[model samples]
Target chain A: MTVQTPGLIATPKPRHAPALRLRRLQEISLGYLLLAPALIILIVFEILPIFYGVGISMCDWKTGAALGVEGWQRWIAPCVSFIGIDSYTRAFTDPAMWHSLLVTATYSLISVPVQLGLGLLLAYLLFQKVRGQQAFRVLFFMPYITSTVASAAIWAFLYNPDKGLINSILTRFGVPEIRWLSDTTGIFQVLLKPAGVDLPSGLEGPSIAMLALIIYTTWVFVGYDITIFLAGLGNIPAELYDAAKVDGASGWTLFRHITFPLLSPTTFFLLMLTVIGTFKAFNHIWVMTQGGPGDATTTASIYIFKQLFQLNRYGYSAALSFILFFIILILTVFQNRFAGRRVVYD
Target chain B: MNRDKLKSQLTNLGIHAILISGALFMVFPFAWMILGSLQTFHETTLGTFLPEQPMWSNYYDAIVAMNGAKPCVFDPAAPLDILTREKGCMIVRYFFNTMVMGLGTVLGVLTTGTLAGYAFARMNFPGRETLFKLLLATMMIPGELTLIPNYVFMVWFPTPESWIATALNLPNAEPHNWIDTYYALIIPWIATVFSIFLFRQFFRGIPNELFDAALLDGATHSRFLISVVLPLSKPVLITSALLTFLGSWNALMWPMLVTNSPEMRPIQVGLRSLITEAGTQTQLLLAGATVTIIPIIILYLFLQRWFVEGISNVGIRG
Candidate 1:
């Protein structure tokens, strides 16, 4: 939501209104007092840390600084010195950072489209005057509300290569086994290798681990997306469909003209959400593989988290995070300028 | 006409097939996790969806692995045989700590959120509109990066005892580490902007006549908040509480960062360590994960309408 300010000027005093200024002053002070608790927390926890993080990013901080000289033992605190843009340059040049960025981009590029298509299809199906659709909607949405870590763990068990349900089912069907989460090789590369052909590195599809996570994410979120799309579909007028039907419009033509255009706002909203979601995706990835099998699924969120927590590279991680923030800002601004104009808001 | 009827019947059958199978895909994991929790460690493998004999002991073992001494003969630190090595998990403590954190966070958020929301919604004050906009604008700053700074702040922050002692002019007033305390877990997430926004939006729907009447009776803003506004705002308050409680309970990375002690860790973080410790033991892992999510799942099932309304109504903003 954008910032919305309604300027309501204080009313001028009426001639017969006795001592109204005191009441007005009380109102102003009381409002500020009421707002103080939330404001103080946000400023200390959110606002201050944002500036503090920026300051940290400008410095040479690798680990904790020695804060004492009591014999051989020393108390350590976070270390920093002004190094200015070095961490940013390093983050850009780091191969690990680039790979993680590529992974995130590739993931969003593939998963968001697939999620949209599947979500739309489900919404359309559920939108029809079908029996038991209400029950079906609840059943489908159960996964989205469940904890991501818990769901991912279940998927992990199901993806176990030796005794997993998926592999067992595949073997029963006479299909060879697939290492679902453990396999790091790109799916296209693996498929093409058996045929004695090669897909170029950058052109290769996501790794099997990435695909598994994608499947998990789709299963979790597609229902939520469908809910949104159904909400959008609910807004359309039935008379338009009736009139189109009377005019010999049918099937794809009906959707192509009326439904699709009317659903543009919802579609655009879901697109931005899905893109941003995939970029900051962490919980599912962390649970399923911990971005595992040689960093196959270590997207930007995971990478920056490791820098901040695992390696204790605060300054470097801060720099990496800002890049991510910058990218999201640009994407949001670009979407607002282009897609926002096209969305048919009622 | 006969041919068309048959085609329509077939189409209906096709639709049922697709929908049922899709739903089966959606539901099977949960059913499996429940079943897996019932199975013993050896029976958790594939091709064995059902246990040979329903192993009720898995839950016991799971509880023991949670580091609680429930239904057990000895302490975890007590000398034990090889079979008793699994009794050392601190799960009950994790649950206690998590509940404490969750309730604490909800109280903090609701208190702050409702107060600010009511003030912004009902109060006419100078710069109220401008300040609210500024609050919303603060949301533009991405939060994931602030973890380190927050962690450092927690580490360096003066302990409550130290502050109290300093204020009271006590002789011994050394700063104690607050890293693993409940304050560190609850305070950082005590107030969220989204909750405040949700509360504000809900409060705005209220008519001004009620407040004006209250004002005529010399009711202050906080008085109206306590007596009139809050009583009428059950739905918003419930939604806000549930969201905050669930969010805090399910939080992983932050709790993981702050609380390294098993005594202080929350259920999710505890579940993580359980997974790591359980290794290939799917029974224990699934059982622990199942325990971790059961509370929220039960809450969702009972308050299905409230939860669904919360999600969908919030979606109205987007």
Candidate 2:
């Protein structure tokens, strides 16, 4: 009653589908094998350590003890011992920590804008085909490559009160030689001393030591900013400038219309990096000041380091580190939110 | 019209002068450091821009002092006990330690990071996205957070209470702590997330078709990676290696933390102690600084092109 298809011969559904799926699973397993080393290292060294750090923050750990679950005694032990949020309370309430925060903020606030502005200006000047630009670039970029410790040491010598070149120069100009590093007195305070302007102690500017650090840091990083700006400048088409010239847009107009907008992304990047770097700064502070002269240059990182290493206050240091991490995090997020929106990608 | 041209020419000359001055300002520290190294101790402390008398002996003294042999011993009975010791420098030893540690780190980072980067770039597996994100998130945490835990690990690893000696079945491990050992420096920095991330980004930019072609040609994943991916990623590898080397070479904090003995100390830490000891010897300190800077300068000169290109690409991609 029905015609049978001879060649097709009532083919049973292919039974190799499951086998194919199994082979696909095997391929994925191979993929995992390929990625396992990196993932394992990241998990151990980076990700797990952060959570471990959080756990350590809750503990009263010492140098000898293993940083295991047993070390969480400070956070968990009951009526006889438990200290809930005490370390955090100590860190947040500590006046030194607050002072450190203020110092860090002030340093970042002043240095970021100046570095970015100068970097952009330099990039622009270079882009204009100034003579010996390559030599100039190398000169500016030289500081970034210098070791931070060496540079700090050099700067420390320069800031020395006696036999410093700066002091000698000041003396030559008929100005009084001011104590640079050892002076905890702020610049504004010194300036206002001659005038009868009474300012509150807290309203004084950063200590001269901190000022020197800021200057050194700015000098070290300005070239990096300039390099970034130069790269950004390269991305802009020459036609944009050509068109602006055709429209009689010269000097300020050309920069305002064509260059600035195009360089926004680089500016945004430099700003974020500078903020993060300034917040996390430690090497120079450690080498130059050791947070000395009554904590004038004790940035958050140095404060935390002192607590952890110098004083062996593990829990408290961990808490301070977390606070710093959050401050940087919040600033980074804010920067991304605003700067990301404004950056001209094209 | 001719007068206008003259005025413009004057303005251009003024601009060039300003640029040259700025360049000089930037370069002055290096210039001074070099000049200071050539001066006598007295001349250096006097802060002369140019050395009054160039003393090549300063370099010899610096080298000898850093060798850390024949240390000056003082008796309180002698009036000149307060004078500086003419110790032979141990800088040679410190330099060796730094090189070994630096190379060890470079090897570890390159090997592990390459593997990880390849997986992240070319492979699609379970938990891949989540793991990558976790890796990125770790970068947000300040490094200080992990410092204590890592220290604890280094001090306590291979044992619960005893040092690594008892656990390793090695004789006389009880008294000696790993704190001042080179292992302390090398083990902690082996897993570099930044390098892994950098290599991953670079690898991702490589085309997928190459991998497929290699696969069609029946090459195994490992072979394909070694022959194709590694060669293709040479620029990034060199860049990362140089950065890793420089970072390890210039490391002050971790080495300062772990190593106390001068015998095991790296150059940065050694330099710190040297400066403190020779605080009065400005010329010697300058010579030490010069010695430290020379290797870096040479490396930079040799790899300048790769450095610029690598940094730009990494920065943009990151």
DockQ scores for all the models shown?
0.41, 0.34
- Which regions in candidate 2 have their CA more than 4 angstroms from the true location? A1-27, A61-81, A192-196, B1-15, B69-89, B159-177, B207-224
| TM-score (chain B) of candidate 2 | 0.83
Which lDDT value does model 1 have at A223? 79
- Candidate 2: DockQ? 0.34
Per-residue lDDT of candidate 2, residues B133-173 (tens digit): 76765666777888766665555544333454576767766
Q: Which residue runs does candidate 1 get wrong by more than 4 Å?
A: A1-27, A63-80, A235-258, B1-15, B68-89, B120-143, B159-162, B170-174, B206-229
> Which pairs of residues collide in candidate 2?
B65-B89, B66-B89, B66-B90, B67-B88, B67-B89, B67-B90, B68-B88, B68-B89, B68-B90, B69-B88
lDDT of 1 by residue, B1-318 (tens): 999789888877877877788789888888988888888777776546878787777777777666643454555465442123245346656777888999999999999999898888888888888888777655555556877778777887877888789878899776666688898999888788888888888888788778677776877777888999999988888888887887887888889888867778888887887777777888888888888878887887777666555555445445
Which candidate number has the best lDDT? 1
Tens digits of per-residue lDDT for model 1, A1-346: 5322222124543862455677677888988888899999988888888888888788665433433333211122334357889899988789999999888998899889999998887777777767998888887877877776688788888888887788888898987889998888788998788789888877678898999989888888887887778777887889989999999997679889988888888888788878778887878777777888889989988898888768767778888889987887677678879988998876
User: Positional deviation of A169 in candidate 1, in angstroms?
Assistant: 1.0
Candidate closest to the true structure, highest TM-score: 1
Query: Candidate 1 clashing pairs?
Result: B66-B89, B66-B90, B66-B91, B67-B89, B67-B90
